[model samples]
Target: MQLAQQRRAFIMETVRRDGAVRVAELVERLAVSDMTVRRDLDALAARGLVEKVYGGAVAAPGTRVEEPGFDAKTALAGPAKAAIAETAAALVEPGSVVAVSAGTTACAVAARLLDVPRLTVLTNSLPVAELVRSASRDRGEAAVPTLLLTGGAPTPSAALVGPLAELVISSLHVDLLILGAHGVSEEAGLTTPNLAEAQTNRTLIGAARRVAVVADHTKWGTVALSGFAPLDRIDCFVTDAGMPASGREVLADTVGELLVAGAE
Candidate 1:
């Protein structure tokens, strides 16, 4: 096996560039055994150079600890979020009340709601509320469900979050909560950089009969400033095909259901 420091350096750089590195990939790249690569990854994780996940290591949280603007985030994982949103939108039944949390993925979910007959969408996301409203009008869907927005302060991510938003969300129960998070991991569950957003999400989750989280693979293994929900609280998780093989196994056993869109 290569010297520990050298192996770790290569692994760290790979994670930095690719965002993540699978154990098997590392093993091959380093001409090392699986155990050797895992040991190097563990050492890197201990140094905060990487974040360990089920079968791989990801670049440690950096600026991700500070939430990015909505437009910035929408560009990072567009295809994965789009696929996840498609899977999550399938969960909404016609005429059901759905509460969508603020995030790019949740907005994607809202974009698909125009076709669902009589879908009442209550949201803390300014973008989601507006998207559903203007899209409904644009499509001229006569049976569009009622739309509700929480009254609160706006965050950089275009989320209305604070006491006012919580009060409004807490008072109303919805058939489902379509959620988006800054990060998600088995260790952290669901997390966000903003504390107000965390509290608002918790309130929304409490008001829902079922909760579905839509996030891309990039969100995995990342824990931000505040965690709002545990894996057990999620009724279903919809992600893209890019999720690591290790994550699929863990989520299958942990969540009520796991859906990977665009997977063969």
Candidate 2:
């Protein structure tokens, strides 16, 4: 098991650095059989970490948190994200204020908020803010949701972060924070690759009474550079049922509640 994990990690790192990996190269570098290399690549592909090509694997379509644009991310986790978002949207009551962190899954959650009237949403994601804006425009005055955006430098992921975003979040409190992450694990918790986004996410957590994180099962076991909080910090976690059984068990024990959104 340890050896498999090490090989998988090495493969991911190699792919991230080179943008792609050939089966022959990995087999030679790791001194493993061709079949072994293929098996490892298959595992990574199953987790959405790599995209298998004809003779090798390329970095998955939305593997890199710091570089994947909003459209790329939305395409990667379509059904799972929609299911998780629908489950998370149920947590918001009409007339309640909510803060959402940047992520594809969280964007889906933002999309669902349009149906709930009298909602006020605070966000650091330009895509999410615009989604709310377009929805409000379509719904007209009576049912429109109030949208507020934080000012800061925008990252490739469409998140606005830095001191300015933090300052604005610190002053306001909301009913819940619909947080997103590069990955979530028992040890690393909610984490992101960008340090500035990490700082702003911490502030968002503080500004909320209840925290509900929306992540797909693919996020399991992946750890990014900066961790914003521990597992216990979240009041609720919403994820798809596709999560590995072991991960589901561990997450349920750590989070206040683990809401599993079905795949179909």
Candidate 3:
């Protein structure tokens, strides 16, 4: 067991330093048989420390696998998130049912949704649920939107996830789903570090007719551990004008409708 542990650690370090590790190189360095090296690589891939390719393994995308808590995430790119949220909120029509996933950007979007009369919201985010509920109360009886929250274990991001959330989302459908992501890329699509949240987000997507992803410029080119939807699955994408020209060009060709949010 000690030998195996040391081998895996060495493999991970090599991949980290070089960005990838070939099977032949690992076999030679470890002085092990080809089969033994392959087994070690397989074990590392399963743990998500590296991504297995045709001939070798490369480092997985994203800065880290573990996600930061809600407060930490909310503090980053606050202005950009607010601007994107405002633009995304404009898409919700009166009486439309909207599903909101967990993320700082989604919470911002929920804050802007109060003006839409007769809107019904379902959410897996505790912050989003509370915001909508409070906003509904402030709106009085005329514009009070019905709010529903999924019952499940709460993540560090305050998202209700697990089987209970998926079960509830599976039975209902919504007009739109406002989703947030840890990372977005042409290859990885929409991704998050928490696997359970990924499954919960997928259910949210399955329950919605249209999917709108709200992300800031920082998310581009990042890839998280679990992917919930393909890039083509997004019906609309709203981001701040700070998005890089290279990303904008790629997104313009791939996404359905790319809308850049300006400072408002």
Q: Candidates' lDDT values, in order?
A: 0.84, 0.85, 0.85
- What's the count of clashing pairs in each model shown? 0, 0, 0
- Cα-based lDDT at residue 45, candidate 1: 67
Q: Is candidate 1 or candidate 2 better by TM-score?
A: 1
* Candidate whose TM-score is highest: 3
Rank by TM-score, highest first: 3, 1, 2
lDDT of 2 by residue, 43-151 (tens): 8776566789999998765455345677777888789998999999999999999998998999889988887878899999999998887776887756767888988
Candidate 1, 7-64: lDDT as tens digits: 7656655665688899988878789899888887776666455788999977785524
Model 3 lDDT on a 0 to 1 scale: 0.85
- Span of ten consecutive residues with least summed lDDT in model 2: 60-69
What tens digits encode model 3's per-residue C-alpha lDDT throughout 1-264?
Answer: 238767876776676568889999888888888888789888767645578898888887553456789999999999999899889999999999999899999999988887787888899999988887776577664676788898899999899999999999999989999999998877778888787899899899989999999999999877666678988888899999999988888788888899999933
> Which portions of model 1 miss their true places by more than 4 Å?
1-63, 139-141
Pull out the clashing pairs in model 3. none
Error of 2 at 109 (Å): 0.8
Q: What is the lDDT of candidate 2?
A: 0.85
